[model samples]
Target: MTRHDPALSTPAQSALDALRANVAVPFERARAMPKAVYTSPEFAEAEARHIFAAEWLCAGRADALPNPGDYLTMQIAGEPVIILRDREGVLRGMSNVCRHRMSTLLEGRGNVRSIVCPYHAWTYNLDGSLRGAPAMARNEGFCKDDVTLPTVRVADWLGWIMVTLNPDAPNPADQLAGVERLVGHLPMRDYREVFREEFRWNTNWKVLAENFMESYHLPVCHAGTIGGASDLNQMECPEGEAAFNYHWIIKNDLVPLALAHPSNTVLQGDDRRITWLLAIYPALLVTLTPGYFWYLCLTPDGPGAVNVLFGGGMSADWCADPKADQHFAAVKALLDDVNVEDKGCVERVWKGLCAGMSGPGSLSHLERPNYDFARYIAGRMP
Candidate 1:
């Protein structure tokens, strides 16, 4: 699709060009992406089109909609999307816009017998087929059977609901196969989502994603909570793949939450003491610890803003413990504190980009994730 935003003028194009050039450099020689990439509306538009629109993005947990007709609606890649469990217990995704007048069909989350448009009441079945349309009998050529909500591709990968607007987008399950084996010890299917929150940050989406993918800033940015127990030197960042990137950090002490439950004998050696942070390219950020798992689904609002849905859960084994309630409260508090720290740091970074006083900075050996992330962005851009 062609983007005609005035923001795509000469200066924005120049900045994007520079960023693409910088990303092409070898990781050892590469500097950070140009500030414009985080401050330019044109570049953000490009990303929405090339990356978000074309990729399979994690929306939320499939378990959230356990029964048939349960549905959730959200905007993905700037388009409204509806995810629902059909009568056959199959998960489906479709455009939320009513085909008649283009009005949105649903809001938030709920169980609905049929998707009835608020404006004209153009009704659709749970499977997205046109069911009823008021006052259409007089229209000679109108055929309800010929109309249906446009289907968006949908997949459930390890219990997470993933959707894609691109008709030909690769299957998320195929791309994320490695993740299953990586965290197979955790009962991902049984880990119910116990908490969820949405936050809007005045920073580029990439800034938040890269921030979560690396451990280099933990000692300084998250000094009060997790940082206190972390040793940056102990981090192990493996080379990133085309679909995802990950790193592991060993905890100095056993996490209290993990200790409250029996250890999964399936975990070997230092795996019990390790925390893994993974980024599924484009926007999904996942953290897997022995005690719990959390994910942040990032969506770019524009060059200077992002919308985030953060959700997490305790492992099935941990949730079965007698002290699960107390432990959950503590874990939630820790997550809240970490969120505050990350917000402050990324907002400051956005301000730095706005100042326009400095160019891209060199990447630290510890920031390999950022290096790979930059290249991923560059590869998606024009």
Candidate 2:
């Protein structure tokens, strides 16, 4: 008879055991993960500590902080962070907690000459050094120069800003090496930021990441917009690399914006006809088409919720066209409609997971990206 150990039987442990079982199955016969992995608070906490906190997470577009004093504040794995361009035009990341009372020093994005604590009015320079303390003069041996905001590692890759709370985490640029060779033909570096928006969804962060990584649902979920343009059978998910998972689908028809622009001779043959979607494990989801690219940076709010930062922009060549504005408006409308459809679908999936009426379901052959995603998560969990 097999013996069960009570020492390894917490809710998080059970969830991880189930997850390992699910991912252990062969790819051709794999089953979906247990709903507990998505609905258990204990499991979520484990992921927050083991995956999100230790991974290099996408924060936002570098263009958003174009000026030296520009800054954006966000929370990563429940830890508040500030990403900013300093006085010398260098980008930096640091804890947003005030050095004095530990209150949050920043709230949203804007240009700030200095970070001032709202609680007790402690001020910090753009580089995170203490500038002034309103009432610390009374304390003996107090050295303002010794105080500074805790610095977080930051990297700018392909126009996106990525931050890591783990000081020892590998730079995103290093992990994403050769990515430029894959999509370098697309004028990404020159693509200007159009707009950025955030959406709160009632679904696990993994669900959203998996949803974006595969093209299986495009024909049904995104039927009205990008669906008809893609051939579901033609979608191909190749073996994923250690850093990310990606798939490609040939478009039946060029998107309106792409059709309007002159062919980017740099992109040969099928490159002009294919769309690639990549998920940088744990959070960043990117979609690259012939004429433009967009991304979602997924962050878990808890076990059953996610906050997504959605943004995109036109290729520099396309943006140079005289009718670019009208074309972009059309693209934006289609994306908005698609997002609405996805929100409903994922939320319904979450509801189903919560109901507990279903067991692990078989995956479609096209869900290879998701299979890899499961393996990635399983490998990370304790």
**lDDT by candidate, in order shown:** 0.84, 0.84
For each candidate in turn, the TM-score is 0.94, 0.95
Flag regions of model 1 displaced more than 4 Å: 1-12, 258-260
Clashes of 2: 0
Write the residue-wise lDDT of candidate 2 on 275-305 in tens digits: 7788887899988777777889988989889
Model 1, residue pairs in steric clash: none
When superposed on Cα atoms, how far off is each prediction in RMSD?
3.0, 2.3
